[model samples]
Target: MSSHADHPTVIVGAGPAGLTAALCLARYRHRVIVVDSPGAPRNSASAGVHGHIGMDGVTPAEFRARAWRELSRYTTVERLEDEAEGVSSAPDGGFRVALGSGGTVQAGTVLLATGVVDVHPADVDGFAECWGRSVIHCPFCLGEENAGGSWATVADNAELAGMSAVAFRAWSEDTIAICPETMPGLETARATARSGGGDVVTGTVRRLRHREGALHGIELADGRVLERQTLVWTPRQRQQPVVQRVADELKLTVDEAGFVAVDASQSTGVPGLYAAGDLTSRWKQSVTASTAAGAAAADAIHMAALLAAVHH
Candidate 1:
């Protein structure tokens, strides 16, 4: 077992990205500590992860467990149930990472796998009322769960209304793309929806309607109500960094999406700092997220080892 205090790299987040990064760093004999913040829920937006290449159908629990089981064999790795709050530079050119519980991690480097989140109205008109059971975000994750049942997509981005429609159609036989415009693509979308046993409607969704905790309909802005069992949307990705204030202190470059800019190895604008996973707009899939993490961890370990050799 590794002493948590001895870890050279402190990783923030315990999701697929963070866990994968931790395993990679541990393989290089770098003591690693993983902090999840609130941890992951079973019904998390990401139901399962992919892109493991050799491993598929890896559930969240199984993915973490297998990595943890193996990471323990290589070097010191500790899984802590704490939310990383902030990080700053140390006088000796190392780093100080703080947690919500007032715990601190002293390290030569920090790996931020804090991931991105798509914001949705919290239960507006009872949408929250049917989440997980009926209302959902990803079609690939929940389409089969409601197979043969009715489903619809809410158009948030006018430009990508067709994207959601096509995604929904590919997932289920019954799908619809809801938009305010009766554009030419709607016909194509509608036809595609029909091929999947779905339809297209034009209206602004006011709220999701539910009864007995089951999704039954959606309320429109004009007061007309449409009945549907499921609501889907391709989230406009929003990236939130864990160290926004500190980034400015360190003069880091952030993109318009608010993600820390990175190179091939996930090195950021600041030295001794790296980022990976959903933190960048690389892609929204679990596989890409994990791969980014591994890349970042490998880079961190390599860089740290090189720095240590220089001093020696």
Candidate 2:
């Protein structure tokens, strides 16, 4: 039901990884379609692309802009604005990708660039409202924002203090790694905290107290109020594999950690099917994802050439 039903390659996301793949494939004169999801990855739980070599400190919006500038060079590249529902396998060894609009993009191969989103803690006052503002998940993203402000690193686990406190103290001289109840590492991290001239708080944070859209402080369970303007924590992430659903010919092999098993070139268990970026279930940065996407696309082209030779 797609307007361009017979495209040779269909990309599922318009993210940096997806767009980069599309731009490369289009330069090779491969028929490509890029489906744009309604929401940008920046709008979600992702802070920024980390570990980029040249673009190490670039923000998410800056990364997206640079990618878009390159993508605009292609006139043959077809871009669709829809959320990919799932991908199905075709009898001819291709793929049929279902879109939310009840259409399907049939392609010879599929690549997924959609990344994972981090899980946040439950409703603890301004927890949700302060996202990307006063509350941050990654130290690299929000560390500079809360500089010189009283900061708190609230962890569900106590052991995170050693690492979190070490990292947090770089931006804030006054950092407290708080856990609800005392377990272990309370002393060690607390000692480490004092070494960095920081305080250790064992109070159960009832809620994040904020006013005027800026973080004010935290309300403690025992009615003790703490004066901290910024909070940081690390959370887990969840991924949706888009390519595996459509390519019935390909077999997905994931690790015990639920990451897709791939070769050096990022090829999956299937021949024509390749995945790049966060879809491989790897802990990724922009540089890694971009390098992986280029490598996978090159591998796919080589395989395609070999297949053409066999047929010829």
1-312: candidate 2 lDDT, tens digit per residue: 121224477777776667777777766666778888877574343445555577665777787778777777777678788888887678787777889899888877777666656566665667777777788766665576668778888775655765565667778877887875655767776776677677578877778878754788888878888888888855565565454453332457866655566676666657556667765654453445655575566457546744765786
TM-score for each predicted model, relative to the true structure: 0.79, 0.79
- Tell me the tens digit of each residue's lDDT in model 1 across 1-312: 332223377777766667777777776666777777665643353445544566655666777678778866764777778877777888877688887898788877777777766566754677656765577666555666666566787763444554554566655555667887656566666665555455678887778878855788888888878877887755455654455755666777878867677777777756667777766653454555556656666666667666676786
Whole-model lDDT values for every prediction = 0.67, 0.68
**Could you tell me which 10 consecutive residues in candidate 2 have the lowest summed lDDT?**
1-10
- Residue 84's lDDT within candidate 2 is 89
Model 1 scores what on Cα lDDT? 0.67
Model 1, stretches more than 4 Å misplaced?
A: 1-7, 38-59, 181-200, 211-214, 236-241, 307-312
